[model samples]
Target: MILKTYRWSFVVTAVGLVLAAWYGLSAHLGIGQAIALVLILSILEISLSFDNAVVNATILERMSDFWRKIFLSVGIIVAVFGMRLIFPIVLVCVTAGLSPAEVIRLALAGGDPETPGTYGYELHEAHPTIAAFGGMFLLMLFLNFIFGEKEHHWIGPLERLLEKVGKLEYVQVIVAGAVLLIVAESFATEHGRTVLASGLAGIVTYLLVNGLGELFNVEEHLEHGEHHEEGAPARSNGPTPVARATGKAAFFLFLYLEVLDASFSFDGVIGAFAITSDPVIIAIGLGVGAMYIRSMTVHLVEEGTLAQYPYLENGALWAIGALAAILLISIEIEIPEVVTGLIGLAFIVASLISSIRYNRAHPEEAHAETAAAHS
Candidate 1:
C-alpha cells in the first residue's frame, strides 16, 4: 500500500539522487562531500517546508483531478527551475543590470573572496525587497485564514476572537496593510520606499490571484445558490459549464499555488546562501526538497489526511502566521532557520496529537465523516 501510494515519490527521489551525484561530481567536489551536502540541503528543505506541505495539501485536495495532476507534474518543473534556479538569476540581472548569462556564470562561480560583485553578493543585497514582498504575501495568506470563520478551532479563544473580528468588512486586508506600513516605516529606513512598494505589490498580487480564483469558482456559486432552493444538491450542474469553469478555476488555483510557492521559496533561497554560496548546489538541494514536498502533498490528498485530521489545516495556517511574522521581523533580526523550522514542526505535531485524541474520543463521528467522504 505504501509503495502504491508513494510510487511517484520514490521515482522522483531516485532521479534526484542521481542528478545530485552528477552535479556534485561535475563541481569537482569529492563524492562523499557532494552527497553529504546534497543530503543536508534536502533535509533542511523538507524540515522547513513540512508546514508548506500541509497547507498545500489543504488547497490541493479541493482541486479537481486534472489540476492535481498538473500540480504534481508541471508544478514540480516550475518549482524547481523557476523558483530554485532562475528566480535568483532574474533578480540579480534586474537589480544588478547584468545579463542572464553573466548572472548564471557568476552563480556557478560562487562568491569572490576579494570582491563583493558575485551573484551571491548581489542577491544578498536584494534581500530587503525579497523579504518585503514575500513577507506581505504570506501575511495576507495567514490573515485570511485566521480571520475567516472555521467550524473546527485549534486555538479556540484566539481563533474564535479573530473569527468575530473577521465579520468586519475587509478586516484581513486592513490588518495586512497596517502591518506592512508599520514594518516598512520602522525597519525599512534604508530602503523605505522600495520596501513599501514591494509590500504593496505583494498585497495586490494576492488580491488579483485570489479574486480570479473566486470568480471562476462555479461550483462555489452553485452551492451558495442551492441554499435558497428546496432539495437542491450542491454539486456540479452539468458537463459543459461545469467543465469550462473547472478549467478556468483550476488555472487560477494553479497560479495561486505558484505564487504561494514563490513566497515560501524566498526564505529558502536566501538561507541557502548560509549553507553554501554555490548556486548550483543550492538549486540541487532545494530542488530535491521541493520534489519531496510535492510528493508529500499528493500523499496527504490521496490518503485523505486532511479529512481525517481536521485540525491539521488549522495548525498549518497558524504556522504560516508565525512564519509571516518572522519574515517581517527578520529584516532587522537574524533569526536562525532552525528556529523557524522547529516552530512550524511543533504546530504540526501538536495538531496531529489533537486529531488522534479527538478520533479516540469520538470514534463514531470519525467513522461517519470517513464514510461521508467515501460515499
Candidate 2:
C-alpha cells in the first residue's frame, strides 16, 4: 500500500536527487558535498512545509478525484517551475527592469566573485516588497481561519472566543488591514508607501481568489440543491458525485490552491538564499520537498487522517497565523528560517498529540464523529 500510494513521489525524488547530484558535479563540487547539500535542502524544505501539508490535506479531502489528480500532477509543475524557478526570475525582470534571459544569466552567475549583480542580491533587495505582499496575504489567511466559526475546537476557549468574535462580519479583514497598516507605517519606515501598497495588493488578491472559490462552491450547491447534512462525516466510501458543471468550480478551486501554495513558497524561496544562492540547487531541493508534500496530502486524504485527528487542521491554521506574524516581524529584523519552521512544527506536534489523547479518552465520541463525517 505504501509503495502504491507513494510510487510517483519515490520516482520524482530519485530523479530530483540525480539531477541535483549532476548539477553539483558540473559545478566542480565533490560528489559527497553535492549529495549532502541536496539532502539538507530537501530536508529543510520538508520540515518547513509540514504544516503546509496538513492544511493542504484539509482542503484536498474536500475536492473531487479529478481535482486531486490535477493537484498532484499540474500542481507539482507549477510549484516547481512556476514558483521555485520562474517566479524569482519574473520578479527580477519586473523589479530590476531586466529581461527574462538576463535574469536567468544572473541566477546562473549567482555565486561568481566578479558578477556585480547576482540574482540573489537583487532578490534580497526586493525582500521588503515580497515580505509585505506575502506577509499580508498569509496574515489574512491565518485571520480568516482563526476567526471563522469551527464546529470542533482544539484549544476550546481560544477557538470559541474567536468564533464568537467572528460573528462581526468582516472583522477579520478589518483586523488584518489594521495590522498591515501598522506594520507598513511603523516597521517599514523608509518603504512605508511601497509596503502599504503591496500589503493592500495582498489583501485584494486573497479576497478575490478566496471569494471566487467560495462563490463557485455556493453556485455548485445551488445547482444541485443539496446541502451537506450538518454533522455528516466529510469523508465516505462512496463520495457524492459532483455536478456536470463542476469544471468551473474545480477551476476556481485549482486557482485557490495555486495561490495558497504561492503564499507559502514566498518564505521558502527567500529563506533558501541564506543556505545557498544557487537557484538551481534551491529549485531542485525545494521541488523534491514539494513533491513529498503533495504525496503526503494524497495520503492524508486517502487515509481519512483529518477525520481521525480532528484538531490537526486547527493546529495547521494556528501555525499559519504564527508564520504570518513571523513574516511581518522579519521585515524589520532577520528571523532565522529555522525559528519560523520550528514554530509551525511545534503547533502541529501539539495538535497531533492532543488529537491522539482525545481519541484515547473518548473513543466513542471519535467513532461517532467519523461516522457522522462519512454519513
Candidate 3:
C-alpha cells in the first residue's frame, strides 16, 4: 500500500518533467541541451539528496499520520521555494551589493562574456579559502555525529530544571532566536555573512512554516511523548493520537531537518558557485533536488522501509549528519562536493542493497519475527 502511493509520486515527478520540457525548454535552452541539463541536474540532485531522505525519514516516521502528510506537502514547499529560492537572495544581499535580481542575471550570463562581479566566487578563485570551507564543514559534521547526544530526555535533570522556570516555551524560542541573531550579526565579512545569513534563514524559515502548519491543523503530526515507542499498536479511532498531542515535538523535528538540509547543502551550493554563479541555476538545481528529496522521504515513510532496515537507516543518518558538518567546514576548506556525494551515496546504496538481499533470503525476517531471526 505504501509503495503503491509512492509509485504514483514518482510517475507524477516524471510527467511533470516532461511537461516542463515541452513548454519551458525552448525559452531557456535548446531542446537537446535542455533535456540533457534537466536529466543531469536531476540525477545529481537526487544523488546528493539521498541521505537527506534517510535523515528526514528518521523523524517523519515517528510523527502521527496527519503530520506526515503535511510534511509531504507543506514541507516540500518550504524546502523547494524557501531554501532553494529565497535563500540565495539572502546570500546575495549580504555578500554582494547586488540585489537578488541582479545576482540572478549574473548567473544567467554564465561567465561566458567577461563581466565584473558576475555569477561566481571572486573569493573562491583563491584555492585556500575553498579548501578551508570544505574541510571545516566536513570535519564539524563528522564530529557532531561521533560526539553529539542522540536521545531525548523528558524527565531528565535538564528538563526538570527547565520546568521550574515560568513560561518555558517563550524562553526556549527567545533563546533560539537570540542565538540566530547573534550568529547573523557576527558574520560581518562577505563570505562569513553569506554563510551565516543562509544558515539563519533556513532555521527561521523552518520555524515559521512548520510552526504555522501545526497551528493550523494542517496535519495531525505530533511528537511521541517519553512513554511511547513509535510503532506500538494503538486504538485506531479514539480522538486520533495526534489531535491530543502538543506541537513542540513536531516543531523541533522540522527544525532539525531544516538545519540538517542546510548544512548538507553548504558544499553543493558552494560547489555550484564553482560551476556557475547564476543564482538561477543554483535555485533550479537545488530546488529540483529539494523536491525529489521530499518525495523520497515520503516514500520511505509510507513504505516502512526504514523500520525494516534499522542499521541501514542509522548509517545513512550519520552519513548525512557527517555530511552537514563537512559542508560547514567546506566553507573554509576545499573538500570536493563530488567526493562527498559519491562516498555518501556509496554507503547508502550498499546498505540498502544488503538490507534487501537479507530480507529476500529470510522472507519472514521483517517485523521482528520468530527466534529464527538469528543470523
Check candidate 1 and list the clashing pairs: none
Report the Cα lDDT for candidate 3: 0.53
TM-score of model number 1: 0.91
Candidate-wise lDDT, in order: 0.81, 0.81, 0.53
Evaluate candidate 2 by giving its C-alpha RMSD to the native, one decimal: 3.5
Q: Any runs in candidate 3 off by more than 4 Å, and if so which?
A: 1-4, 7-28, 112-116, 122-246, 272-282, 353-375
Clashes of 2: 6
Worst 10 residues of 2 by lDDT: 235-244
**lDDT tens readout by residue for model 2, 297-334:** 88877777778887888898889889888878777888
Q: For candidate 2, what is the TM-score?
A: 0.92
What candidate 1 gets wrong by more than 4 Å, as runs, is 112-115, 219-245
On residues 306-367, what C-alpha lDDT tens digit does candidate 3 reach at each position? Answer: 65663465457456545644544444455766777887887687767776666677676564
TM-scores across all candidates? 0.91, 0.92, 0.62
**Candidate 2 Cα misplacement greater than 4 A, ranges:** 112-116, 228-245, 370-375
